[model samples]
Target: MMMKAVLVDDEPLALGFLKRQLEKVSSIQVLETFTYFDSSSNISVIKETDIVFMDIEMPERNGFQLAEQLLELNPGLEIIFVTAFNQYAVQAFEVHALDYILKPVQTERLKKTVKRAEERINAKQEAISEKPTKLCINVSGELMFHLTNKDPEIVTWRTLRARELFLYLLHNRDRSINKDVLTELLWAEVDQEKAYAQLYTTIYHIRKTLSNYRDYLTLKSVQGGYKLILSNTIIDLYVWEKKLKNLSTLEGQTIPIAEELMAIYKGGYLQEYGYVWAEAERVRLEQQWVEAAQQLAAYYHDQGNFSSAERWYRELCNKHPDDEISNYQLFKLYALTGKNKLAEKQYQIFKKALEDIGTGVPHTMEKWYMNWKQGIARKTSM
Candidate 1:
């Protein structure tokens, strides 16, 4: 497997040496090099990088801090710290670095590190290949389905109409769709006879495409409409909504289950499809997500658990940056947790985001911040 590698060192000489050594490893591809860590330049590329050859000692931030940031962007990223000092050996291992090699780098030692990285990459690929195949209908992002076995191939449709028809049926799987209505909606400009013929052709291709999973699923024409006979299909939207419905019955204790349900929602329903029919369900699912996140954040904050509250709010903000409420709550939680710098940063970002949308900070938010500021001042005076 070709591994994407990044080299980072303040010393240009060390970087050059390491880059040359890495070039000898046929498996490693040096995608980029950085002498310093900056969020804008580093985080974007580092998120997609597999391995990083980092220098333990550096100006501004040490290798450990850079590793921490990289791991935050991608937890699966393997870091190998290269430093001349032995004092940082224990600290290097503490961060779960892939390997630590002493500078004045020996070829044998570097090769050992590369071997370990290969083993890790191979193991991950094997684990993925071992997962049981399922017909996964992903409505949270692009409307697509794929078998999750072997190469994990995506099921492609013959046409856009065929894909949309499949998505519409899946979205409304609880009931069968009327054949006539579907034809009119999908092919409104075409003649009724031509539209019906086209619809049937699309259905034929869809069935042919999903022929492998025929034992577990089938398309059936019943009464005046078609229904998907999915005895063993995994629809993400259905599963997510079902889990959310169960959360209400948990009687006030809904933390663990709520979190699990919320995490299943990768994005809005059929978000990339941009179909008008999907908007209602998409909006409904998104609202459910927002409500669940708000309740969880509020529950933790009210219990005086600022750390957990901050985490949930920050997650919400990351997913929905335009969510002013989540941003505001996160800002307050940061202050309560004695993260004044983070609180100020969150406030500034929130202010700028609102301004970009042609609005100023909400008066209520301003009032809350003023009150908090006054409280902080009183405490500092004492």
Candidate 2:
């Protein structure tokens, strides 16, 4: 079945251009085109479509605002944004949009995005077939395994490492773990020959255990060593990471992604493993989180939503207490809101935190904090 699509752009040229470009791909069926998002119009015209190619700068309401309304009528709709600006990446992903195509969409990129959509749709359809067969496999006497969320035969409580082969491969996501690295990470103390033989046996058991659902997941040998080939369907972490990306972008528009991001961020990422790549990714995402909060705070502040700005600032303060600039901003904001005591308290915290970090306050900020605190204290005392 062909995937239905629609183009929503207020600009005539942009709409016409995307329609023509998308028409090149016969598989993508553009059902309708909307110049603006008007509820009075039968929104179902676009809502019924499987995918939406929407523009952010449409008249009346932007893409996100429009998407909120559209999804009320169509929950599972996939939106691919066609935008002239890239700065809105955060907002795009915040909504869980399928993908973002910059203006003047390239044929190759559009095709790739379409292919990805096809893969997802196919996986979803397969999931609806018959509730997915739930089965289990016991690897040797130590390992228990699962399919479709069903726990395997438990001779004993187990972890992925119950089968050393799966443990090493599972730890390596989308990357082939080298035999030497596996030897080092898995069994540095054991004899090399013994380790290799054990590894081969482990691999065989893994394949045997997972053979039933091989289409959904597999362990395959590569030039380097081997790869655990699992579809995006089974890995909740992939979905979790992608949800973060959607919330992080300006186009991956899905509502409730915010709640999902917060819920999924219950703990440090991949808390079970401390692989170098995993740790690096964790730090990168954490940095991105702070940067995003800062951007959103500044955006809200400029939009005259001071309360929201202050909320984000406070969160940032808690996360990055040593940031002198963030502290200064909060102190000033507190003073503006007539919370002199709170401002004074925050300034002291800032002073102490700065001192603790061994970075002295800047002269300009020091003068302001001193002056503000003294003035407030004098006003209270007087």
Best by lDDT: 1
Tens digits of per-residue lDDT, candidate 2, 1-382, equal 6999988898889899889888898788888887975755766685568888899987668998877667657756787888989988889888878888898889999999998888877777787785666433322213334565565543331235435556456647468877777766666789999878766776777677666666556787878588876553334344455666666442225323543454444334454445454576556655656665676667667766789778878887886788766787888888887878788787777777888988877898889988987887798798
| lDDT per residue (tens digit) for residues 66-166 in model 1 | 88878868867999999999899899999989898998889888888999999997887786687545777777786656566545355778998888898
lDDT of each: 0.83, 0.70
Q: Give the TM-score of candidate 2.
A: 0.48
Residue-level lDDT for 361 in candidate 2 = 76
TM-score of each model, in listed order: 0.55, 0.48
RMSD score of candidate 1 (Å): 26.0
The Cα error of candidate 1 at residue 266, in Å, is 1.8
- What C-alpha lDDT does candidate 2 achieve relative to the native structure? 0.70
- lDDT at 24, model 1: 90
Candidate 2 — which residues are off by over 4 angstroms?
1-172, 189-191, 194-215, 234-264, 271-277, 348-358, 362-364
CA displacement after TM-score superposition, residue 32 of candidate 2 (Å): 42
For TM-score, the strongest prediction is 1
Clashes of 2: 22
